[model samples]
Target: IAARLVISQRTAQGHVEHILSKLGFTSRAQVAAWVVEERQSSS
Candidate 1:
């Protein structure tokens, strides 16, 4: 989301952390996979 939003790398990292905490995910890879799955489903 931060990448798409054109935010800095550090900001993106922060967003990833927040997302992981909110979603109960332990890894950024899991969050990335979820984002991909979500986009595919929405499309």
Candidate 2:
């Protein structure tokens, strides 16, 4: 994500942390699952 965004690794990690907290998710796996679900629904 950092490479794609042209940001530092720590910045990417901070964004992930913000997302997790905002979404009330406790794990990356849960975040991944939510992303998949969102994509499927959007499609």
Candidate 3:
């Protein structure tokens, strides 16, 4: 996914860390679950 975005892996990882910290999430799974729930609700 980072490659596809044309960003370095480290950059992508940093972005993920920033997102997790801002959202108060401990893991990617929690973020993914929240995204899915949000999408479902919007639809």
lDDT of 2 at 32: 89
For candidate 1, write residues 10-41 as lDDT tens digits: 89888778878999998978878999999999
Candidate 3 ranges beyond 4 A from true positions: 33-43
Ranking by TM-score: 2, 3, 1
lDDT of 2 by residue, 1-43 (tens): 9999999999999999998999999889998899999999999
TM-score of 3: 0.64
**lDDT for 39 (candidate 3):** 100
Q: Write the per-residue lDDT of candidate 3 for residues 1-43, one digit (tens) a residue.
A: 7999999999999998998999999899998999999999999
List the candidates' TM-scores in order: 0.52, 0.67, 0.64
Q: Best by TM-score, which number?
A: 2
Model 3: lDDT of residue 27 = 90
Stretches of candidate 2 above 4 Å error? 33-43
Q: How well does candidate 1 score on lDDT at residue 34?
A: 90
RMSD of each: 4.8, 3.0, 2.4
Model 2 residue 14 distance off true place after TM-score fit, in angstroms: 0.3
Q: Which is superior by TM-score, 1 or 2?
A: 2
Better of 1 and 3 by TM-score: 3
The 0-to-1 C-alpha lDDT of every candidate, in the order given, reads 0.88, 0.94, 0.94
